[model samples]
Target chain A: MRNILAIIERELRAYFTSPIAYVVLTIFVFLSGLFFRSILAQVLQMGLMSQLQAQQLGPRAMDMPGMITRGFLSTMSVILLFVMPMLTMGLFSEEKKRGTIELLLTAPLTDLQVVLGKFFAGVTFFIILLLTTWIPTGMLYLYSTPASGPILTAYLGLLLYGLALTAIGLFISTLTENQIIAAVLSFGTIMVLWLVDVLANNAESSTSKAVLTYLSILSHLDDFMKGVLSTSHIIFYMSLMLVALFLTYRSIDSLRWRG
Target chain B: MITVENLTKRYATKTAIESVSFQVEKGEILGFLGPNGAGKTTTMRIVVGFMPASDGTVRVDGFDVFENPLDVRRRIGYLPENPPLYPEMTVAGYLRFVAKIKGVPKEKIGAEVKRVMERVSITDVQERIIAKLSKGYKQRVGLAQALIGDPPVMILDEPTIGLDPKQIHEVRELIKGLAGNHTVVLSTHILPEVEQTCNRVVIIDRGKIVAIDTPQNLRFQLQGAERVFMEIQGPVPEITSKLKAMPGVIDVHTVGSNDGRHRFQIEGELKKDIRSDLARTVVQSGWGLYELQSASMSLEDIFLKLTTAEERE
Candidate 1:
């Protein structure tokens, strides 16, 4: 546990010492603000004020849960797609390139400790970036009657999305010593998952479409956006994270033999 | 203590090291002298548990390397050919991180880092970023990292490869000072570095152990035939005949002529001292004995002979 914490601290230091963390945070904030403004404009244009009055409630009494959920979920997912690669691209790639992997490999820490430590560090940084967007998210509570259920679900969904992407990014990082290659590969892989829903809609067979939909991260995230946390969706995201981490462990293990 | 038996590492069709075996007792500084591509780095990597051997067993402090790597790693410190350093980190940060990963107690980490920094004389630059430091200072930081935790065994690969002359001397002194307390196995292509710093030498060639012995013994063992080099102001044929006729003189050959002075190489039995006899013989024969000295083989020649002889066989 001490070794794991040491690795995590080292990784976090590396992240903040460079421009990566700042760049990721800046982009996340900009996108979140843009999405919040867009959602607010749409709410005003749809005359949610008069609609609530017709429902025998005050102008601010109507629940804007759907708008809040869609706005937060869509913006956070996009932000995560871009920020996660930056967070994880250097995890193992930089170590391999700088030859520090040998130092860590020969150290007293186990393989699990190194992989999990790096994984948790990336997740932690992602969470920090995700939490920063919550300031705008919390402001929605003042203007409209937003259901806390969907708000909580959206945050949970964003966390799962970030977790899954971090794992995949870490796995790709372990595949190469070139950070550019790792980032590009991770981005390309995530893009494919992002387009899985589109591909599924065009499928002729129900079974193939259902399979593709189940595999799509967006499809699972939709469940959380609707204030419903299905066990299957939770299991799906967690399993993907687990598999990516397991592959990362194996990649690090293979380095000792082939490096 | 470390013992490697029948160690072999083959990568697909290429063999890095094969059936190479050597033992290092406690507190012994074993110098691994080999040319580039001689598998010194590969063998060290295996011993450090960074890589697995294709076939063989390595025991460190009574623990098998493959089976109990953490146990062995806990007792060993390794510095590869390249110092594994994060350029963005300061020396103090880097060493502190190393101490943590190396399993130094949380409370003692600060003191351990300071102690190693002082030992390597890099305390002045403890706060300087590693990428901005000089190569010598970087190498010193690398050495300092290896000394963290005061592991009983240290495996240094080409530790002095890129250092300046002064830095090399300083590091050599540091390594020598480590003798009698840490079992150090350092690899280098520089022969004299080994002669100066190591108590014993293991010379490897083409992924094989060619010779293992003390520096003096290796020089002595490879000095097969006793020979004396002489420069005389006399006729070449006359001096050669006189020297060849001396007691215990096996053969004589005129090496070369310099400024009208003839030089002859006289070979004789190993146990004989032919210097005085050749001087007397040349002087009594009406020849001027300008210079007479015993011909000695250098470490380079011994290394070449051993490695090349193995190739021939």
Candidate 2:
């Protein structure tokens, strides 16, 4: 456990000492603020039209807070898919490039410790990125009353989604010594996971469509965005995270063999 | 102590090191001597548990490398050929990280890092980023990391390969200082480095152990003919024929002449000192003996003879 923490500490320092962390953080925050304002504006415009319609006819219920929060978070998730590759590209690739993986492999720590330590380091940075979004959401608390339960559940969903995506990015990072290649490959992978749902919509066969939709990462995230708490979505994200981490462990083991 | 038995490392299509076997007793400094592409790095990597050998076994501190790698790794400190440094990290930070992962006590890490930095004389650059340091300092930092946790065994591959003369001297002295307390296996192609620092030398060529013994022992074993350089004021033909016909003389050649004196190098059988007999012959023939000196074979000649001579056959 101490070995894991040492690795985590080293990895975290690696992220912060370099320019990559600051670059990713700045871009993520700026994009989130832009998305939040636009989603808020669209929600407000719809609310105004609805109110005007209610004044003309009878009153109709529309959960404005639900629509705004869901829209903002879904857009945020898509943005994470793009930026997460930057955060995880150097996790293992840099070590391999610099030949520092030899140190870790020769140390007393097991491959699992190194893998989990790096995985947690990426997750920790992802959490820091996720926290920045809270600055925009905190503004919601200042002006109007949003449903606390949906906000909580939505944050959980984003957390799980980010965890799963970060795991995928981490796995991809182990495949190459070039950070750019890792980043591009991770982006391609996450893009496929995100676009699978679009493919599902155009499929002619019901069975193929069902399989594609189920495999689509966003399909599992939809219920969480709608403020519905379900065990299946949680299981899906957790399982994906585990599979990615397992592959990372196996990949590092192979590196030891081939070195 | 480390024992590597019949170790062979085979890649997909070729062998990196084959049938390499040697032992480093407790507190012995074994120099792994080899030319480039001779598998020194591969053998060190396997011994330190960085990679597994394709066949045979390695036991470090009595723990089998393949079966009990963690136990073996815990007791060994390794400085790879490339130094294994993270360029972005400060030297102090890197060493601290190494100390921690090497399982030093939390409270002792600070002192341990400080001690190693002081030992390698890298204390001044402890706060500098590793990437920004000079190559010599970077190499010292690599050595310092290996000294962390004070492991009983150290495997250093080409530790002084890139250093300047002064730095190489300092590193050799430092490695010499490490003897009697830490068993060290250091690799180098420099012949004098082995003679000056190592208790025993293991000369490897083409992934095989060509010779393994003390520097003196290897010289004695391969010293087939003793050479002597003599300058005499005598006719070239008479001197050459007389020296060639002398007892214990294997071959004789006239090297050059200075004024009226002729220089010749004579080869005699091992353990034979023919200087007295040659001098008496020259004196009895009425010639002045200007110079007579015996030249012992250096480790360089021995290494070349062992490595290349095998290839020639």
Q: Rate the local accuracy (lDDT) of all candidates.
A: 0.89, 0.92
**Judged by DockQ, which candidate is best?**
2
Q: Write the per-residue lDDT of candidate 1 for residues B9-113, one digit (tens) a residue.
A: 999779999999999999999999999999999999999999999999999999999999999999998999999999999999999999999889889999999
Off by over 4 Å in 2: B231-247, B254-263, B278-290
**lDDT tens per residue, model 2, B92-115:** 999999999899999999999999
For candidate 1, write residues A1-259 as lDDT tens digits.
9898998999999889999888888887888888888877876766655786767864454345566557666767866777778889999999999999999999998899999999999999988987887788767666556788877877888888888999999999999999999999999899888889899999999999998888887788887887888889889889999999999999988888886
Q: What lDDT does candidate 2 reach at residue B147?
A: 90
lDDT, candidate 2, A110-207, per-residue tens: 89999998999999999999999889788887877888888888899999999998899989999999999999999999999989999999999999
Interface RMSD of predicted model 1: 0.6
lDDT of model 2, residue B87: 92
